[model samples]
Target chain A: MNEIKIFSPATVANVSCGFDVMGFCLDTVGDEMVIRKVDKKGIVITKVEGFDLPLETELNVAGVSAIAMYNAIEVDFGFEIEIYKNIKPGSGIGSSAASAVGSVFGMNELLGRPFNKTQLTEFAIKGEALASKCEHADNLAPALFGGFTLVKSVSPLQVLEIPTPEDLYATIIHPQIEIKTSESRAVLPKEVKLSNAIEQWANLGSLVHALHTSDYDLIKSALKDVIIEPHRSKLIPLFNEAKSSAIDAGALGCGISGSGPSIFSLSKGLDVANNVKANFENVYADLVIDYDIHISKINTKGVKIIG
Target chain B: MNEIKIFSPATVANVSCGFDVMGFCLDTVGDEMVIRKVDKKGIVITKVEGFDLPLETELNVAGVSAIAMYNAIEVDFGFEIEIYKNIKPGSGIGSSAASAVGSVFGMNELLGRPFNKTQLTEFAIKGEALASKCEHADNLAPALFGGFTLVKSVSPLQVLEIPTPEDLYATIIHPQIEIKTSESRAVLPKEVKLSNAIEQWANLGSLVHALHTSDYDLIKSALKDVIIEPHRSKLIPLFNEAKSSAIDAGALGCGISGSGPSIFSLSKGLDVANNVKANFENVYADLVIDYDIHISKINTKGVKIIG
Candidate 1:
């Protein structure tokens, strides 16, 4: 049997208004998975590097992803799977999503690429659900398609590719913190004031418009979050100072990436991007700032197999 | 003293999730305001046409718009303002907004067009506030700038022009019923479930993404309103049928235009637009369905003299 290896980029889920439905792949961060077909009747898993990840078929991130695909499609072929964990677990940078999506993408290749992008996304989402208990596609879509992507609907797992301006730059700062997705989900209120909801929608609408037109000023103004950010910011250390420093350093906007701990800043120019990184590093002294900024154009190309 | 003829396009406020902060102008339906400066120091009443409009300044749509503009800029110049209303009042096609925006546009022209589009939008919003008691820019921004415009912020009135797809088409239907904006606003819940709010934001976020990329399918899926439309639909007669017919007739999606009584359908081609218009006309027997099938194009010259 031919050996297949595929690498899936780590993704940023939630993405403000998108919550469980929207996400994008990061070029500089993600995970790698290798799959090889064998005569064994059951799936076997191995984890390499970073964190003591679960290896159980029912409990592990990669194992769940592979099992979901096998059950859904009734694929009886057994395989050995290896996950190269690069994205830090629980950093809120879609660490689990990288593993889940990478499993499906690698498995698909090993199985001769039977499923399309949308189909792969569905299988990956099942893996995500097992890990997060929420049917979210934000991370999976971007992982599969690359760049800045939007998930229109979750039930059918509809994804849309939005145009990202060439001048756009992203600076991500992963503060070393352990905040589980389940914990963050619990902190959110079950009911929200109608006024706050309206403001969130308005800002979200404007953000989309700004992105489409490549209007920096509108993007800057619309990057505000009146609902989730206010509540989640309290969990992150020096969240306000970090956001303020990023904005003051000339970022168009700054916000908590995914759930918490990690933060991303969007800038219009390289100079501003560097400045934002510097400010973020200065504000959070203990923060392990990833100076290797994901400064490429919006990753339009999602997950692809490497020979 | 100068004679000026100005036309302001009818606007669709809210534009789905934007509520008070977003709007766009319709090329086919609008109000025309002809203003002539008079020697008097105070504003004077003039002629009003299209729809049985009231004559009193307080009750008059055009009068309130003029007053809002005058109050904002402290203009003492008196003028005879004739509102040649084309878009019907209380049709949810921005009838009042057309008058309000028209008045500001006309007055600016009568005063040698001093204020810019943003300034005119501010004045129009003030006029809108008088009628709705809430400062919303959705109608004003579109009326003042035309095309798919976004209100990034309300307090400082930040606005941006979103890219309009070349093949974009809009088919609007006026159901001839009176669904007042006040009543529509009254029906909406004071609070929303947190789950619903997140879904709304997710859909809204995707809608913006779809608009930017001209993703027709995504737009169709994202046009849903789980919060406002369900409640407001009960008020408008044949709301569900009109939408169903419109979608069946090849519309990408259909929703209440602004508040209600009018339904707007989006499509990708002219043939679909015509079909959608016919569908609405067939279902609503008692209504005057004006099929304003417009190509999605930005109106750069907003509220100006037609020389």
Candidate 2:
């Protein structure tokens, strides 16, 4: 297969109590990419559509990630990538991760599946760093491995693929307000109270167990952020209102999606997810900011061949 | 049942990454007690054996826990408890928890199980506070719920009973050197770095997932303590040597059982657990301090009736 067209899914990072460690893939929102091997020496970003992004090989996430994977393999020819972006950057729904994971996934498929998911995730992290300004795998791992992923250790890059409940769905709302990655990170405290940290880990542990057992009630109880959200939520407009509305609408839990300007909520079924989406719309309609809402089932398959 | 004899197992709290939140019950190391319904209006400790402990209802853990459960119910008759203790206090093996849980468990059984495991744990925590000086349930939850337990929250009192693998075993070593609970508490930092907390929670989340999936390799990788172990290990003599020896002897993971002086290692099977026990023996043999070691399977029944 010299050419492959694939769909790379969006992801939600900093999942409530699992800040900087846990994330899950989304089924509905994503980016479409086409990659084809050519006789050229290096990677080339031939085209980009739907959103204004750098087409240069070094500037674009797809190009950078593709190059990372490309340099590690023994290949005589280079690859060309074309990305049709649907997820907006800085939307806090892993727009960069979709582009990052897409290039490596498509190239791996065309290269006869030369690398495993972890290796692909490693390559994707380089691309993700281009947008997020850090090499974090919470989003990249889920985007590569699908389902819920836990970045257990970053130095060793060990990620655990947690089971997603059958009825689990995600409702995401991206407010059209930009929050810079630097500012988003700057809002975080360097030190946290030991008691709060313990509570956060306890909630995270319970959340992982709830996912394995498919206990929706436990998920609701475990979906709390006592450390990161209190400070970062201040950066997002109407974050409190959005979260409260989502919870009232029967979302199992709701919190800031990534950094800010976007929020994600988990529900047990498609009906409740749609309800959460509607409530998000109701809450955001009163504001002047333009917001987009998407309801998606937990993506069991991360990047898939489309053509 | 007018009178009943029971076996109440010891437990290991703060299991590696799950500090103050996770614990598991032990099958071999435990205490025995006899509880009976009496015509008296309050709890009575008629006889105490094997260890010197206060017989007063307010001072003794068993009497205190029994009173907590007894006060909540409208029983026309009181109860009599006889303690036959085997576990040593301050061993970091939940000796206090055994007595605390044993009393509530036996009282509940005699009272036709008026309380659930969570209610029993709440009562047990009251007794555990007499020794630990804190209201925590990591030990009490497992002693009552059996298997593994995660104390998600202390305020509303939530505990999650996690599944134990079929082949899982524990090796515990008590160095006999006393590490005061106050000194242990003083060693912990009030605040921790955000990065370390993230790593700690990540490991904890993975550990829970590993337990659910029964993946020994994942458990080995996930059973790490990045936040609490470093400071607390200093309180225990030869902690590093014992942990290294246990790991070298095929233990999956090892850490301070609760605060200090006692260390617990988890292995996949009985043979590996015994090997870990022998290694612990070798490590502590050079020290002048007297030490004791016990090997136990993961106890599925927390407190059981023997007569």
Candidate 3:
């Protein structure tokens, strides 16, 4: 009861039609953190594993997020935390969110679960902001609450965990390359056409409807991102070919995950998810590229205690 | 079996956050049409009622829509159509949609239902174009599909009929004023801030979730219209007061119905709907204005054969 080891799942943000408002949690790849209450007055990083992330307590995403949660509570205590990073930073899948959510979730449990999910998410975003440089919760929400989450409004810190069909699956391909979130975001248009905006909202509506109704064909039709993907795809190598190949292999649709260097596709069955992976492997082979592919069902349980 | 009378309900498009992608049909207010098969090879309007709409076949929205359906069937037959108007044009409701949908629905019945709801909607838009001068299906889709409808893609003609909660009710107030659709549309900004667009999309995503889950509080939060309501409220009389009063009276939310001149509010119960209606009357009384109000649940049956 004095210490705990917790896990936070990886996440995919801006899921095609969702743009800045949507994201989903993944089941396989994530981050692990061990937190124990200390006698000192502030957080400290005892150890870090798997990647060369910052060792300073305030500098790391997990440490920063833990600090936010520590400051929110009235406990005159500190924590020494150990992190095992699995989701690589700049993977465009939620590397930072996994770390941030993992730390906050673990710290909350160590403090006897003082805060609810929404309150914990607020603290988590502070840690995410350290890396993202903006207080956006789209990535952290699903990592915190699990499944498909919508950041309805950041000002009010409103979020909703939407339902997904049991048979749905996700196929993600993360290329062994770095693309800064800043660089990826800089390519998007400042102003979208009104007609295009209408089309985008309609697709978003359909995507949400498809999720509620469990309609696969409707989901396929709803996954085309007309605005951001068209502009940002150029930043990611072989983006078009990978997307087209995935669709050709029966992916519902494909697009850049979060920002760039990684792409994802949705499928209704294991066969389609595997087919999408094979298609991605072929594209990488054709271009002499290196990539890591993960086939996972949508994660229902978010950050949880492992030990 | 040769003659039939069909009624198409009026619709409210752009339900707050949806803009041009969503609409819902009404139960009490609509338009009626009578169609008969004659020994001819084309469609014709033998009689007209109410306002002085164009009598020429191609000029009338109803006539124009009927022609689109008649041409598609290749039945080597014609229709003699009679229009009886009830829904008032320029009410900021889908009056034109009623005419267009009523005619196509009646003629399809005369043609022995050759076209389904989707096909009938396609022909109906051709008639709607004669009125709006643009082939937008936001209004007609609901008139055909009934209940809540989403025009997911205008290009591929993707439309969906969204489910509504059994207890959800709508309160609409039509002020005795005229605001042309052109004039209403002219007020919108050509480009919206990306921040606002993000906020808008989040509201839309929440709205869809609310509809699916039947969460009243979620529906209230999701019903807020930031982009269009602010711009279009200027065209309507006492819009802010009416909206505030409706919300104060326990209505979920209120905003301009389609563009302006007419306003609609959503409530969870009949008592609140009536309370909203009384509040709107108070607003009109304070402004020395005249308005007509209708209170009803979400219409489940759309265009129907009457006689």
Pick the TM-score winner. Answer: 2
Comparing 2 and 3 on DockQ, the stronger one: 2
What local distance difference test score does each model get? 0.74, 0.91, 0.87
lDDT of candidate 2 over B256-283, digit per residue (tens): 9988688999999999999999999999
Query: Which TM-score values does chain B get in all models?
Result: 0.87, 0.98, 0.97
In CAPRI terms, model 3 is classed as medium
Candidate 3 per-residue lDDT over residues B142-258, each given as its tens digit: 888888898987777989978887888899999988887788879998877666676777888888888888888999999977788899999887889999999999999898888
Q: Per-residue lDDT tens digits of candidate 3, residues A83-192? A: 99888889889999998898888888888888999998999888999999999898899988998888998878999988887878899999888777778778888887
Please provide TM-scores computed only on chain A for all of the candidate models, following their numbering: 0.90, 0.98, 0.97
Ranking by lDDT: 2, 3, 1
Which of 1 and 2 is the better model by lDDT? 2
Best by DockQ: 2
Query: Which is superior by TM-score, 1 or 3?
Result: 3
Descending-TM-score candidate ranking: 2, 3, 1
Of candidates 3 and 1, the better by lDDT: 3
Q: What is the TM-score of chain B in candidate 2?
A: 0.98
Tell me the tens digit of each residue's lDDT in model 1 across A40-92.
Answer: 76678865666778788778877887887877665555878887787877777
Off by over 4 Å in 1: A37-42, A70-78, A110-112, A286-300, A304-307, B16-18, B38-42, B51-60, B67-78, B110-112, B166-177, B180-182, B267-282, B286-307
